[model samples]
Target: MNFEIPPGLTDLLQEFTVAVLRTRPSNLEAFAADYFNNLNEKKNGPLKLSGALRFQENDTVNIIEPSDGHGSSNEDDDDDSFVGPPSSYRDRRKSVSAERYDPEADDEGDYTKVVNPKSDEQRRRLNDAIKHILLFRSLDHEQMQEVLDAMFEKIVDPGEEIIAQGDDGDNFYLIDDGKYDIYVNIDGKRKLVGNYNNEGFFGELALMYNMPRAATIIAASRGTIWGLDRQTFRRIVLKTAFNKRKKYEKLIEGVPMLSSLDMYERMNVCDALSSQTFRDGQQIIAQGDKADCMYFVEEGNARVAMVNKADPTATVEKEISRVGPGGYFGELALVTNKPRAASVYSVGVTKLAVLDVHAFERLMGPCMDIMKRNIGHYESQLLHIFGDKANISDLR
Candidate 1:
């Protein structure tokens, strides 16, 4: 008899076969053999009942006597009806341990273990977290991923030394969570310098230069850190920072006094000024100290004090002048490379733009000559008014 399989029945049979292959097997050899035989019989033989069997292939069936066939139909049917193996054997092997495998076990053992990070769906979350940890921004997606992949997380317990002072610096760290105390050896004491919290970073100066750790970073609380090794951190920082410094140099060149400086002179001034900072009430150019730089006050006020040493215990010390924003002081030091005749101290928090003596000489050579001539003219005017009784030579 010929069998006709509906389209829906054929599809259902195929899906059922796949499910059986995945889920049922005591002896894989016997299961495979029976599966193929049944498939072949369905393809070749006609079903006595229509739609009872699905045809996956087209071939003619040749009925043979029981003695001539591999097995009797009844025997084949009994074997076919046998359900193979436990369901647990058909289930996929799950990783039991990461270190080693058990050969007899169904578990995947060491093979499946991995440091699972954010999945594709959670990539934005990972990126945002990394963004907060990184010191510099402006990295594109691909570059950011490269950086993130290189970074590894670490946990530090309270009082642990994250980085020791005076040690040769290597890796730079970004705080992912918790806090750290920064300490530096000041006046032979380990002074608490500052505290770093989440998203804060340290060891940047090491990446810029192969300098020793300027301060020790200790965990004030149980902290988590994500670290990028020196090589990678340096590559990113150097490219960005160099470009930024160039922009700053251009801005500095716009200043009137420094505008006349040549590229080499400006570079020297830039290097010299890199180490300079001013605090409130800090004396920049002390009286009688050999002045090596000219300072342009970018912000805040400075008082210029002139002392009349002739009257050592004078009730009131002389106030020569005061300089505020846009004003430059210590130009005489740059011009003459002589001891400062007066002191200049910040009246409040100040930012100073400094030009070194060499830069001044190179940029303002002719200007210095004009200033000397003007000083002489003022001295003559003062001499005329004082009638030779007052000495005016020291005024310059």
Candidate 2:
């Protein structure tokens, strides 16, 4: 059948090719021929879009959104596509646009999806991916749902950049389908550091402090992902995590030196902490070794001790303190950046929430005031008396 090409229609196809394919226009005749054929034919299959159809251009920062108000379907053939563009190009050249979508026509819901048909699967996969990440553990079911409302899914082809290194972070992502290689600029060149597949997630660090993406995450193969915007993240996840962090503030508040920390300081402390578990007799701190962390026991018991410097090879010195639930230790060595005055080991299986001095200072630099009070006034005389006692009981 002989086909008549519309004026500027060839140009429009070229523009779409360049914008969506991320490739220079080539063989316009072949591209136009195929696109016209697909537009007029009623074919049934998934459609694959090559690049973001619409993205802000010539900007210093990269923040892309689907220009067509939707992304192409992931089809067998990687072409920028949508519900097979209306029955015939000759019949609808002026009206055929990338900006509109018909869900009834879109086999796979596009980028601006409001209600997901595969919501059950999406929720389960999203929760599973997020469960192990410390940053999201505090969110309750309702909050998780609110987060769900703000998220949407997308599929990227192999070699596509999911998140670029050194870009302003605008979204957090969870992998739902395939693998992606992680890279970070090391020294001067981009270095492959790691890879993550289904159920793995990244972009948390960027949200935590609004910092530039630390690493570039590229799709190792065609992959599907669920993404939440930075605004939704701060509104739902960050707010919830901060609220949950307050529940642990009492643990910080009870510590004499840390008692003076205000509520915001306490929240920062909670954010800086990590939960840990130690089996019975597991060494937590080594006596006379450089130590710079503190802990708060949340479950079970742990014993604190110091090396018997007098003998140099003693099995264990007298137990300095038996820390039960809610008790904390490691304040002395961590704050001073000195050799540990004592060693700590789990008595039975114990669980503790721990924070390193550097983390604490990084989260709140002024909080060093708390450490100064701990080491200079409280631990000074005790160290003079017990020599290397790891616990604060010597002062009591």
Candidate 3:
């Protein structure tokens, strides 16, 4: 009988090998278990592991999540061979059990409405404050307005417990006016672990992953906060994500090079995209620079320019072509793993969807041959303009 090794297993083993060699953990069994566990959680959704269990060279204990008490002592026990003292092991486990969860699981729930008592001035200020937060930055204008309306204000007196450790989290809070202290319960005592002031946010870990609060937050002064309840937060964030994917999928579908990709492949490409914007005349990709990411024009246009690389004193660039919406550029470098062949500048106020090189290699594997065949066509156009003085190979 003949058997074959799965295609994905090779890549998985290669990744695991690199991780093992980099960390040099004393216990391979424990490290493998922890690595695979983290990988699985990542596949399901975003996961934030306790800092104590991060795969640093000096630390090897697994990240502890809230455990069901029914498991046997040994079943729940840390590996005896794990580096560090026994007390240290126990203390690490005592940190907030930040659970892993799929945010999409709650997509069917109705969005909760919070009464907006804020005046015009307050609403403007709140919008300014949260507009830059990573979680809210990707939301569209309409969704952002919904977020602002759902977040209600809360007033807390000095020394009030905002959230208790080990309790289920219901709201994600953003501080507006005063200070708050973060504490972790260790050995039946509250230990001051960190602090947050105006503009700082907390409780997201629990709400994001359905985990218990990892730490207790107490108001250090008479402070004001903006809170979005769990149901509303999930509804906004997950819906925005879902809509963005559908939008990008449609964009990917229209690109000529990616036209050959199947629906599932196109969806994977869509998931890897991130959005960026540039002002008129801003340099998007510099010639001779190593390429790390490729760009697709989502809105407005970009100018592709190239210089005579063979002449050291040739500083002027000639506009070679324009890339309008639904068109893509910067892929030559990603396909060849070389320096950019030409500089790309924003023609006007441009919005771009980007995919990094790693994602390009992983998701665009099926399109590699098609991309390579087009490289000659691209170079020929450059040759027509520069008349062989450009030495395009060096620029590539």
Candidate 4:
């Protein structure tokens, strides 16, 4: 029950963890669930790894590991009983539309090896296929469309291995018709674990890295599937993030406050930003509220005001400033969680690039490191600008 993970596999786990983090930032609970399942799925059947993180979907993540992850072997796990005969497979195969893909048909002028169904049913299913995964749920409608666009259909025959447990993963698959039997190898023998039918997906982790497949999936019948290669999948998954980062780069380029930073440093700041939108009358930052994030206006307008503490319900607020596209507020908040000095509200509908405290620190680490290395030089420059005795030790 206590299978020790090989030392070499540690790197694979770390790499997998980073990909999951990038795909879904700040959701450690989801990471734990997916990570453990990843290791468990790779377990050599009755012999399993015990030290992987233990968790459930809704449960709080726990760092403790169970003593044993392995379950006892069953005599009923025989491969013959699990895998039905070729004739039985043909019976199920008859349920699917064979006209969709002709085995004898040659692709004389087609761009793909598999033939797509004439109806829109496959496209609808492909869109619905990823709805259940948390990472996909984070995507907006347009971003999700990119994922669907990246995918293409593949017609597979019965008994063919869609993906083998030890093979390098280049594609993430979603079954469109028929089924696949999931199998894991234990001591060079394949053992059936489960089955995937229409809409079921696998190989999502491949979008991040080309690790070996955790389990083997064999076609139970001549079936249709939609698959996205690693390159296309990665582009879809990272499109929003990279797109926003590029947008921020352009936005930051126009901000005079960031002019002192080098291009690379400016990019670091841009990469930390996350896009946000505000409805009319929505308060972006409230007076006396903790300042944990800042915003850069992408569209529309906003008004800055100060609350009248003497008359809490006063109809008139002290209007301090008005800013539109390419403008920003809460710069001090990125450095520290101090109480906001004023309030900001959307004048109409507004879109903004927001950077929370964590992201600001993370993407700006390199810039901070450079400052740390040149602290003495910076201190002298500040002192020269002010006076010989100017205080610069606690610049934070």
In model 3, what are the clashing residue pairs, if there are any? none
Where in model 3 is the C-alpha error above 4 Å? 1-112, 246-272, 276-294, 298-303, 306-327, 330-351, 355-381, 391-396
RMSD each, Å: 34.0, 18.9, 12.0, 13.7
- Candidate 2 scores a C-alpha RMSD against the true structure in Å of 18.9
- Backbone collision count in every prediction? 1, 7, 0, 0
Best by lDDT, which number? 3
Q: List the residue pairs that clash in candidate 2.
A: 46-75, 47-73, 47-74, 47-75, 48-73, 48-75, 54-67
Query: What local distance difference test score does each model get?
Result: 0.51, 0.56, 0.67, 0.55
Give the lowest summed-lDDT range of ten residues in model 1: 63-72
lDDT of 3 at 25: 66
Residues 1-396 of candidate 3: C-alpha lDDT, one tens digit per residue: 111112233224324443443345689788877776656553544543332233335444432221111111111212212222224324433333434334335445454566667789878988888875545655878878888888899999999978766667778787788877765554455555456656567666566545566666788899899988776676676445555666797788779899877544565566567799999999999998999999999999999998877778788998889999999999898877788888999988999999888778777777888888888888788788888575768524
- What are the per-residue Cα lDDT tens digits for candidate 4 across 106-171? 232443322334347766877776675433543678767667767788899999877655455577
Q: List the candidates' TM-scores in order.
A: 0.35, 0.43, 0.57, 0.43
> What's the candidate order when arranged by decreasing lDDT?
3, 2, 4, 1
Q: Could you give me the TM-score of model 1 versus the true structure?
A: 0.35
Q: Give the per-residue lDDT of model 2 (tens digit) for 1-396.
A: 111112222223322322222222377446544553443342223432223221123311221121111121222222111111123322422211112212123332233423344568777877776675555655667766767767788989999877665556678887787877765443344445456655456665555444556556788899899888765665556555544454566666666656655443455566567678899899988777776677888889988765455545566566656888877777666555567777789988998988777654444344556655655554554455456633454222
The candidate 2 region of ten consecutive residues with least summed lDDT is 63-72
